[model samples]
Target chain A: MNNSIMILIFIISTVAGYKLIKDVPSLLHTPLMSGMNAFSGITVVGAILTTASAAALHSKILGAIAIILAMINVVGGFYITDRMLGKFKSGLKDK
Target chain B: MELNIVNIVSLVIILICAADIKLMSSPKTALVGNRIGALSMLAAILFVLIYNDIITIPLLLVSLIIGAFIGILFTYKTGGVKIPQLVALFNGFGGGASLIVSFILLLEQGSNIDTFARFTAFSGAIVGGLTFSGSLIAAGKLEGIINQKPVTIKAHSMITSLLLIILLAIMIFGTVIDDYIVTFASGATVLSLLFGVIFAIRIGGADMPITISLLNSCSGLAASVCGFAVGDIILISLGAIVGASGLILTQIMCKAMNRSLWHILTGSTYRKVIDSSTETIVEIKSDGAKKEVHNYLEIVNKAKNIIIVPGYGMALSQAQEQVKLLFDYLIGKGKDVRFAIHPVAGRMPGHMNVLLAEVDIPYEYLCDIDTINPEFASTDVVIVVGACDVINPEAITAQGTPIYGMPILRVHEAKHVIVCNKDTKPGYSGVENSLYNKSNVTLLLGNAADTLAELISQLQNDLQSDTVLQD
Candidate 1:
């Protein structure tokens, strides 16, 4: 029953998410993605919270992996963001 | 679980955004984006609950109010700047978010990381990182911080191909070598970063809208990878939908400029811009056109249909409000005033729309280039405000010019043309206008803003004088 419920949630979330962004005008996608990036950071917190709360050995191990990947995601994402932002500064290469 | 306050807060924001979208008004500030984003997520969650048979009707109503307040706060704080910059800034966040989500999912999977999970995680991280960075560059360019030149070199072709191959090899071989994987992946990431920057530098500012759209597509793909990594069907589906659309836009932009996408990025195709050094030519045609231009004031009062064409000069003049003032006055007097918007007129996409919207002009008054071009044939007067290149007639006549075969505003089609150029100069394509020589076209040489203001103020006085004389 739980597995079925999970599956139903997954299917609905997929459809709902698709409905929201599927028709987003190409012009508006950048702002949409940028906003979502900030919000996506919440997932890292979610992983950490799961690690703290879960009692099962496998769950704990999964939580640890989630934490590490989350850290990498945040770090790599920010690094690239900063690098790209640097291009906009004056005295960079012409064009 | 029952629907709670957090869910409610999210729903209201989405409703507002939906309303805004239905009205076709883009959001201005990061805050509006935050609210709208919050709302979209809320709506998605609600849909999730309904699909799972989790929500009661009462819970949904309360959530809407909470979401609405948050949405209002978000929109209120950002001062609502709706432009390409806002879009780029938002996309950077989305790409970065997906990358993070995938990372968390990897950790959640722990030792149970299957082959599918590993593939998705790596793909998401790499693409997401690239999107996050690429978006920032685009934002910087739009924000007036980046170098706006095409960074071209002789060996760019060979270098790009080789680096891409190396990156692919690292992804395939490094996994077996386990310990070497991180190093290889990091190297690939670095190469990708340089590729993005160099690739961007090769495309000129005029092509930035296309670049922005392309980077957006990459971001979507990154999110899709994250979706697969986490088994999040929502992420995968939404990402794919947007990714396909972005790619189509890139294809269209490339075709418009008569260049393949790769040729545009490598800077190999347009070798002509480099061979030429442009110089200003000041030819004084002291003919009686200057005096004749001033005569336009006499007809201003009686003119029934007045069409205004705005350009970069008008943008530089920052006289959009004053232009609106002229229009408002005309409209008040029961005269028809319409805008002739050239597709590629301003520095960026929909630039004039943002400026005009800020001044509260009805969107209906603005007409596309093709729509307005035909109107000029029957129109009495076309008041061109501080524009240079897109309105030029030379593109149609001079096959030798780089802008040959490019369609432009048919300002020459009008019975009487009033052109306001800063000086005798070419536009973005570095070609002089052929319309200047036409007898019907009067060159009102001055700064666009001041000239337009003068015309409006002068017309008011003439109308007043005529009224008093009749009384």
Candidate 2:
């Protein structure tokens, strides 16, 4: 079982997935994004891993840099997202 | 053939991920469901690190759990980010992480130039860079911190097109630009990021969902590419899953607006006043229109069945209580009362419902278009309060109109239609309502609550006088 072959399969599927998504209609976006927001949150973990893994690795410099960027993505992502959702909350005054 | 506990654990984690797809339908539970799924995934990854004896790090697990708790707290605090902005931020985060991963692998692989690893490294970095910037723009728009109106850049399409061409040329012909190839890539990343901001801002509020979805797809593409760069199969598969789903949602949104994805993304949409004439409809003067209001009450009092259709204007004018008052008055005298609600009525979804709910209107009396539309024929008088677009007869009667196919309450289907609105002018799209011109429609010119309240007062006075005459 070559890891390279497995990686190629994953890449090919992702490209195909992109093509599949490109073909869908635009109306379902809000619902779809809402649904994916949960799953795509894997990035939250990716954020911790970026710095955590990098710091432990021999190249402390790269790991430290990765930590900073990952923190930005995590903190910024959560902050901005909450603000955006807030706009739709309560109710539209119908104006 | 030896299977380790890490392999067994990974299989369990994959199963958990597969089962988590069911949470998509009812997103109220998505946060909790995803956290559990994410935790399962983190644990599996942790197991991989430990089983291989790669390293023993307890802080990562603690931080991961803490991060999951913070995410849950966010859901409670802001009530979870709305779907579009949430997606945008998620895409950005995903892309940012993928970018970092690609960069790390590059440091390792750059030592051996011309290797497959280098190709993956570059691919991941570029895709992640694009996704990161694009997501930021999308997030900014949805968050309302940025203007919802599209930013009209000078020479917009031409600039983006030229940039893409130059980037393609640079990527293809490497020899001519030898000294600073990496620099060119870096420059392109900046340009893409800048363009991403401009591209997102170019889309107005009505179209934010589509842009966010497209960006979601981009982030997924970035992740898959990074998976390639770092040789990770699981990441690529999951990226494909997300990218496909996001694009499907994007396309659905385009169709709902009766548009193509390309036109929506590329074309500039604005609130244009299409050739409208206030003159052609025999514009009754305000006084003449006021006279018609008296006759309308007579018809309403005499009607056997009545359905009231309320909309945004009614809510804006705080007329829900007034309508509720009218409902009680009518029902007290033994007249039928019901309400028609459109699915996408007002400025947002279910807006009318929320307003009516506030007024303590029974849910049973309130019916969505599917159930209440056909019942309009049986209704004798349909009093539409501050509801223009939703009750517009043009939606059902005129095929040439922009709202032609769009579903609307069939208030006009009643024997008599009473339209109460502030402005004689058409609604947001400026489409002349056929209901306004119909002989059966008696236009009421005043604030919704004021008009309805006054009408009720007039009816009460007349009833008392008639009783006196009978005595």
List where candidate 2 sits over 4 angstroms from the true fold.
A1-32, A44-95, B1-11, B26-74, B79-87, B107-127, B167-185, B271-471
- What is the iRMS for every candidate structure? 11.7, 7.2
Candidate 1 ranges beyond 4 A from true positions: A1-95, B1-38, B43-82, B99-112, B174-179, B251-260, B268-277, B282-292, B465-471
Best by DockQ: 2
lDDT (Cα, tens digit) per residue for candidate 1, span B351-461: 564456557666567676667777887787777887655677776788877677766777778777777778766665666676776666777778777777877788899
Candidate 2 CAPRI grade: incorrect
Model-by-model DockQ, in order: 0.07, 0.19
Error of 1 at B224 (Å): 1.7
lDDT by residue for model 2 over B1-471, one digit each (tens)?
136553455446655654554442332433444455555655655564566454455555444445545544544454222434544665676676666666655444344444455555566666677678777776777677787656767887777677666645544442243355456445545655665665666776555545666777767666666655554445556666666666665655454344567765564553444334444543645444333445666677778788988766785687888998998898787887888875444332334654565465654566767788889988899888877666776876677666666667778778888777876667644577667766677877789889888889977777776678979
Reference-based lDDT, residue B312, model 1: 62
lDDT of each candidate versus the true structure: 0.56, 0.58
lDDT of 1: 0.56
